[model samples]
Target: MLRALVIVPTYDERENVPIVVARALAATPDDVHLLIVDDASPDGTGELADGFAATEPRVHVLHRAAKEGLGPAYLAGFAWGLERGYEAIVEMDADGSHHPEDLPRLLGQLTDHDLALGSRWVAGGRVENWPRRRVLLSRGGNWYTRLALGIDIRDATGGFRAFRAEALRRIHLGDVASHGYCFQVDLVWRALQAGLTVIEVPIVFTERVHGVSKMDGAIVAESLRLVAWWGLRRRLRAAFELVVHRRRLRSVRANSSRVV
Candidate 1:
């Protein structure tokens, strides 16, 4: 029953937005509000969200001037929810791939964790109606992410996640630069770097039946590049710190021997 704001970012999702909004609201009836961050969809997705907000007090809308990307839209939503004093902020899809019925379970994990990530690779987690190739792509990408980033998360790229407001503050949103689905990996990296408690909640992922998926070759490429770069940078920094520590220790020993 935390004061939670579910942020759903959309671009040209006219067919799925209303359905998602209604179902999310119905699934989490109390103390959970919906914020539709519409990126000025040419299909009038923003207008549809406004219509819902006008009638349902629990629904809210944030209209952006243009489609920037998923990262920026969610950043804006986080800011909005934080300013209004929401205890938890959630990232959800407007395409219905992330089931609204599973939202409560994600929130439930927040009781003892800083972040609750809805994962498809964990025990009891499964996906439906996904092609074999798509399934392989997702599984391979997640495995690569874990190996390259050295993070224990099984689904760092999954967009279905919940964050305690304090955890978001600790992650330093101002430093985030990723714009695509890699943004999910970036946030997870930052959360781990910041030493925040993170847990994964298993959920069933269903492929969107409506609009075309936003995934593309470019997004996958970006994730690969960023993950590699982060891993390398982390190793270099650790090596440098170790060298510095050793040098300091040697100097301290030499000075002590001289004094003796």
Candidate 2:
């Protein structure tokens, strides 16, 4: 039995936290536990999390002092899961963009994969209630990152994902530099580089109606810059390897032909 834990990062998401927690718990079997990482939202979300943790055996809470970036919160939660011997772990939003019902499907894909991504760019996935600009912005970012990273996984920036604990343990947490949405892209790229199998599970991303969205132009811009930088570095490394191989091949051919 793979003991799983869902890490939900919350900031001023008072109204939707309880609902999302319940739905996530109800949508899965009774064994999957949840850890809500609240960044001390002024909306009393931390207290609410405490109340729920008091009652639910599988539910836990980690209340931070202030609002930090999403990646750091999840990093903390990941460490917590690791310490407790969780076999698998997941990261999700408390604003309800990540559907609780989709957790099972993502987990199921892990049987044959090292990581399973809930992707919006894959077939059968959709976005709901987003403005035209938001859609275009997201689509453009996804396409740009895909080309820049030279990777094929759709929805590279999607946060709804499941990882085998051993795989996550292999990745260096200190080397993960991205502090925002781009963190997802960095992790996926690094996991691929480590020769781990990653599969996409189609999912719909819905805009939250009750709370302010954490997505911003700055995060998108940061993603573009970081991805481009990594892409250049990867390309340069590959070019160097190719040159070395070609030189070796030419030397071998000259020795073998021996026409002189």
Candidate 3:
């Protein structure tokens, strides 16, 4: 069995953390371990995680000083797993939106692809208990992201994914800047840029039943701003490359004329 570590980041998810951790442990193979990275939840989520880590050998906890952001928390987890020599690292939500049962399918796909994305927008993929407005918003956001980034991935914002350590290392996690849900988009874009093979597996995303959601208006705004900025930068880089190529062609022609 391949050695894998599932990194679940939590913030005030005291109610959901234990259930998610248990499910992840039961659902995955024996070789797969779970790491809970808690951002000093005032609700004592870190304490709860510590209790689990005490008895469960496969379980571990990393406590941060305060709520930093999803991106930083995951980066910290990834670094820890890499240092420990885990071959595969997984990203999962502390909330139940991402089912642990689907982990095997996602990790299995890593045999051929460097990244296996548990996509909620692909064929056979669906979401439960989501209102029509929320569904529309998610679909529209993914469409906009696909167009802006010029990536063919169907679910750019989905958080559930499995990454081969080799591919994750190539992405240079230090350079990642997104701190909100857009962190998913940023990493996928980076993987594509690094020439990593990315494949999506369909999965159902269910809304969380416990704890308050972390999404806010500011996070949404940040995602939009970053996506637009990246799109513009890509366009500008392309245009500059075109100009350089044209200049090189002109110089080559001038030299040919002189030789003639």
Off by over 4 Å in 1: none
Candidate 2 has its poorest 10 consecutive residues by lDDT at 169-178
Give the alpha carbon lDDT tens digit for every residue of 62-145 in model 3.
Answer: 999989899999999999999999999999999999999999999999889899999988999999999898899889989999
Candidate 1 lDDT over residue span 1-260, tens digit each: 68999999999999998889889988995799999999999999999889999999999999999988899999999999999999999999999999999889999889999999999999999999999999898899899989988888999999999999999999999978889999999999999999999999999999998999988888888889998999899889999999999999999999999999
Cα lDDT, all candidates: 0.93, 0.90, 0.93
What overall lDDT, based on C-alpha atoms, would model 2 receive against the true structure? 0.90
TM-scores for all predictions:
0.97, 0.95, 0.98
Question: Considering every candidate listed, which one attains the maximal TM-score?
Answer: 3
- Which candidate model has the greater TM-score, 1 or 2? 1
In order of TM-score, best first, we have 3, 1, 2
Q: Cα deviation of 128 in candidate 2 (Å)? A: 0.8
